[model samples]
Structure formats: structure tokens, C-alpha cells
Target: MSDLPSPHDWVKRSAQSLKVERLEAFFSGHAFDAHKHDTYAIGRTLSGVQRFRYRGVSKNSLPGETMILHPDVEHDGHAGSASGFRYQMLYISPALVQQVLHGKPLPFFKDGVSHDPRLSAATAALLNSMEDELDPLEEDDSLYGLVTTLQAVCGYNQAHGTTHDYAAAALAREYIDDCIEQAITLDDLAKCAGRDRWSLSKDFRAYFGTSPHRYMTMRRLDRVKAAVFAGRTLVDASVEAGFFDQSHMTRHFKKAFGISPSRWCLSLGE
Candidate 1:
């Protein structure tokens, strides 16, 4: 398919969870501006040529190829061919990765695309059907398989000398979850985790793949999304989610998901 019959773009999201967010989307022209996410953006292009810029290099993911974009990496998306692109993406929280890998640094795929059969199979188990809700145990098993496959594909060494305080980071994460609707400071996290602020910040990033503030913001965004999906207005959702206003929440929403809140709601058929 070298040419798209229509130029319309759309996104369809699966059931939302803090551990992962799944979506299938198609775009004919520009898909997204440069943006960064705090979760690993792993996906497979189903048709056409999915193209993006990552690590200062332009890359294309052909049909059935796995694209493993690292957390917090700046990238953008568009169709590499005129047919446009259709794909399914799984945005997994690094905290969940840490649950399986312990305190190790998140697995890295220097090149955004991978051809490993193990990874392809593992991702297919998760992305094969967006319409069906995964059973809780089935979801856990799939995530475990995917994370381990990613580690193997990346050739991560278990003996890398990097040390992370997983306990401290876990404590800090719990505190953030408990206080997500309030202003959170590094000092607050440090006090809760019983670690020094700076060191805890480092540990948090190493274990969670994002800063404390970013994690807190993402959690709040999750709340906003839930509220909006429950029929609350954008302004009300923002306020309830602890953002100053809808515009403030919108900026972070775009930065994290590469789409505005209103656009995202429309994609949900709201």
C-alpha cells in the first residue's frame, strides 16, 4: 500500500492502567511533534511504513518490525510512505519493568527497531488484539514475557556495577501514589523514603525511568483521564487532578502522549 485513500488520523485506546497503556493508531501525514514519554514506547507497525526520528537519526519500522523506544527519549512520528501507517503501541511503565528486573537499569535498544523473533512473539501476545480485555493474570504473564524478551534482545548484563536503592524508590513511589493530588517535592519524597533527597532522586530515576516530578505528573494525568472518561468536564478534571487549570494539564498531556487532551478524548469516541 503506497498511497493512503484518506488522510484522516485516529487513535483507539485499550483499558487504561498505571502499569501500561495500549493504543492502536493510524496516521496519513504528520502523526506527532517531537515529544517524550516516561514509559517505554514499544509497538509494531501493521501496515505501510512507520517512521520516526530517535537519537538524532531517522528510522523506519516496516510491517511486523518491533519499535522499542526508550523512556524519556525525544522522538516524533509520521508515515514514511504515502500509504500512511497503522500500528499498535504498548506504553509500559518502567516501574513494572523494575518489578521483574529488580533494581537493574531499564533495558535499552540503541536502535529503535528490532527484528528479534522472541521480542516479536512476546509483543504480539500483548498487541494482537486491542478489542479484548486481558485477564489480570494473563496480562501479568504477558508483561513478564515481554520484559524478559526485551532484556534478552538488548543483551543487558546483570553484573553491570550500577547500584539502585530499590527499596527507597519503592517507598517513594508509594508515597507519590498516596499523595498524587497534592504538590510533591523531592524533600517530601526523601522524607517518606528515609533517604537523602539527591540520592533518592537518582534511585527513583534508575528504578522508575523518570524523575519524581514527572512520575507525579503522570499519575495526576491518569486521574484527569479517568475523570474525563467518567463524564467530567476538562476544567473540572484538571482541577480535581490537582492541575492549576485545563491549559496547564493540557501542556503536560501533549508532552507525554504527543496529542492534546481534547484530541485524545475524541479518539475515545467521547
Candidate 2:
């Protein structure tokens, strides 16, 4: 067996309301535990070599390579070099992904890792923004661009396959907007606009760049975030946003924005 180093040999810096964290360490170490979240853990290896396990398989991330960890999977992390590992992780919500996809079906990347240049480039832009102060509009524009870019990279073709006769995804989008507080399903979205679930999912992503489920979560987060900005308690915000609880909302909120919603609110002095 390969002997691992100490777990304490690590350093972490983060902005909490958002789920993203910038880590640089010789992590002569390991993760605290094998844990899973309700968000996509997307990140880049900056220096040395980073190693981890996902979906029951071991993987290595070289510098400039992006590591995509789907939410709710058990995984562990460690360094492959004496220099340790350096990386920034963006915890992405399925909902935010859906925003780009509209009400479309979710696209699956068969590989756990990707070197696709489009995804790489778009990811770099957002990761880079972590270092700067951004206005909501500026951030939204960049985020929207990246989301759409990712859909394209994931093989969402606007001109082909599946939804050949569906109406524009606009109706589904409107239904989601109007029914933000209710429980919705793929079948519901398809029925809302007379499209098949798969076609609706496809058009949602083709038009907005993410899946229906993901879009709903993101929209809910937006409300949760808005409530936070307005000074509602986390519990209140979570319930209002349809999250199971504050902890659930916190996980998703941090995943989407890179910091805990509470801390983020504090940072804003609201």
C-alpha cells in the first residue's frame, strides 16, 4: 500500500458565503473525511500534482488540468508531490448549471476529468475573478457566458438531435419563473410547454445552458441569497428557497458563490 503523509500539513483560505476555496499546501496530508456535497466541485491544479478518488476510481490532476467532481459523491484528496498541491475549487450548483441550460435535460460527461479547451478557458475566467471585486452585473455576465460555453463544450448542439419539433424553451422558462415556490419535475416542465422531458431538457440547456433541475435550484438560491441580503435568518431563507434546511441552503449557497451565505452577508455589511 502507498503510505500517505500527515493530514495537518495543509493550509486553506476561503470566502465562505461562496463554496469556493483557494488552497495551497504541501498537504503532507488528506481530507478530514470522505464527504459529499450537493454541488459540483470544479477546480484546477496550479502546481505540483494533486490526487483524489471519485466515483470509486482514483485520479490525478496535473497543472492546468480541471478536476470535475459531481455533487453527492464520496471522495478523498491528497498531494502527489513533496511540494504539496495548490488549487481553487468552484462549488457549482446544478441550478446554476440549469440557468445556462434552461429546462433541458442534464448533459453527462462520461469522463470524470476533462482537458476540453473550451471548459478550461471558461473556468479560468471565473477562477480568475475570485481575486477581484465584482459587481453583480459584471459577475452575472461572465457567469452566463461561462455556463453557455460549458454547455457547448458538453455537446449541447443547438442545431441538432432530439427536440426537432419542440416549442421554444421560453414557456418552460416562464413556468419555472412563475412557479419558483412549488415542487417541479422533468415531466412537469415538459408538460408545461408540450415538449417531451428529454427534448425540453435539451432545449433548456441549448437555450440556457443547464438542466431543468439545476435551473430550479439556482433560481431558489437566488431567492435565498436575496433574503439573506435583506437580513432574513438562514433558516427562514433556506425554507423560503425550498432547501431542506439552513445547512442544506448553506451547502448550496457556498457551492454556487464560493462562500457561506451568512459570511457573505457579513462581508457585505448588510
Candidate 3:
């Protein structure tokens, strides 16, 4: 097990892709303001009670229960008990889930917390401990199993909707990867993919789990994280990563990731 940070500490690990962000944290009380991300916040409470508001309902996650917060929903976090709560979490992108489900609407959990044994076991391996180094194959395999388990548990039957243009959306995603530092507009992506802007926008979100702008921002954020890891100052990194300024980068960084840049650096021993 990785050494726990001091009380009220929040520490995150390193992941090369924005598709995944893993962390182990302890919160004495209110940990974050109401915020939403473009990825599912899936985690397990290890000790004490994890309390949060989801879908306008108050929910409590005790140790051994899995908490699944769907993408793009407002939620808040706090420790439910005086002793505080310790937990491990993985922020998984909807695109990753779409890779498995392939055009299905993202699964929804009516309740934010679950005690299902299968779902619990599936996440146990991935969220086993904060320090476990995941090799490429192991990580991919675990992600595959995890998403399938979620689908089964949530009864996601892949309802039929307007068929999405995955190929076009994929082209836009590739273009974003190629021109990460440049300003990219929906029209730009639409031109590249040979699709209508509004149609492409809906297809992109359905296929990739976020809008074109958000996908670009996350890719840029990935670069920012890499730059910061390479000893570049935050200001330099922000500019190099294509943000307007440090504050611009900081705002999206916290919104996408739940932690500030400096704290992320400190947790990484920078």
C-alpha cells in the first residue's frame, strides 16, 4: 500500500492518458465544491462514511460500497463522520466506456451507491491499492472487465437511438491529437471529418463521451501535466500546453481533475 498522506490529504497518481485518473485520498470534511467532470467518478470508500449529493439526493457510501457518479453531473464530496473518510477512485472517461459499449448511451445508476458483489469485486482489482503499478496489458484488461461489469450491473441494454457517426467522430479525435497546441473550432473539426458541425457535435459527444471543445481541453491538459512533470513552471507549462494563461489552465484543470495544479505537483513530489 502507498503511504497515506496526512489527515485531510488528497493525493493523485500519474496516468499518461486523460482517459483515466487514479487517486487515494482522505477528507476530514468538505473536500470539494459542487462540480462536475466529463468522466465517471467511480470509487470505493475504504473507511468511515463517504457522503455526497447526487441528482438532488443526499447519498452516503460506507466502507465496501461502490460509488458511481455519472459523467457531467453536479456533485459534492465530504466525510460523513468525524474520523473522516478514506477512499480510492478512478476517473474514467466516457470514451473508454464507449469503446466497449460502442454507441450505447452511458449507463446510469439510479442510486449513487451500490453494494453489488460483482461490481465491488470488479473494481477491487483496479482500485486494490494506490501504489500498484499497472502494466499496459493489465490495465487494459482491467478496464475492459470493469466497464462490462458496470454495464451488467446497471442493466444497460444499449437502447437504439439515432445511429452515431463514429468514423467521423474518430477522425475529429485523431485531428485533435495531431494539432493539440493549435486553436480548434467545431467548424474546424467538422471540416476535417466531412460532417455537419451540429451533427458532428452530437456524434462526438455520443461517441467520445465529451464535446469537441472539452475533448481538446482534456488533451491539452494532458500536455500540461506532462510539461509540469518535466520541471517546467506552471506558467510556462500553461502557455506551452496552449492555454490562454495560468489561470485559464488552472480553471479547466480543476474542473476536469478536482485538484489544483500546485497540489497535483506536490503530490507528485515536484
TM-score of 1: 0.92
CA lDDT scores, all candidates in order: 0.87, 0.65, 0.81
Instruction: Please provide, for model 3 over 57-127, each residue's C-alpha lDDT reduced to its tens digit, 9 standing for 90 to 100.
Output: 99999988999988777788888889898888888887788788876767888798999988898887678
lDDT of 3: 0.81
lDDT value, residue 125 of candidate 3: 69
Q: Enumerate residue pairs that collide in model 1.
A: none
Among these predictions, the greatest lDDT belongs to 1
TM-score, prediction 3: 0.87
Tens digit of lDDT per residue, candidate 2, span 1-270?
Answer: 122324444434343434233333344545333545555677788877787777888788888787777655556677777777777777666556666665664454545678888778777866774546555575567667766765676775343544533254667877888898898888888888898788777676654545667667777987886787688887998999888888887766655544456545544431
TM-score of each: 0.92, 0.54, 0.87
User: Residue-wise lDDT of candidate 1 within 1-270, one digit each (tens)?
Assistant: 221223388778887655678899889888877888888999999999998999999999998789999988889999999989999999998888988998777888999999888989999988877988888888999999999999888886545566668899999999999988888889999999999999999998877888999889988998998898899999999999989999999999989877788767777771
Give candidate 3's total backbone clashes: 0
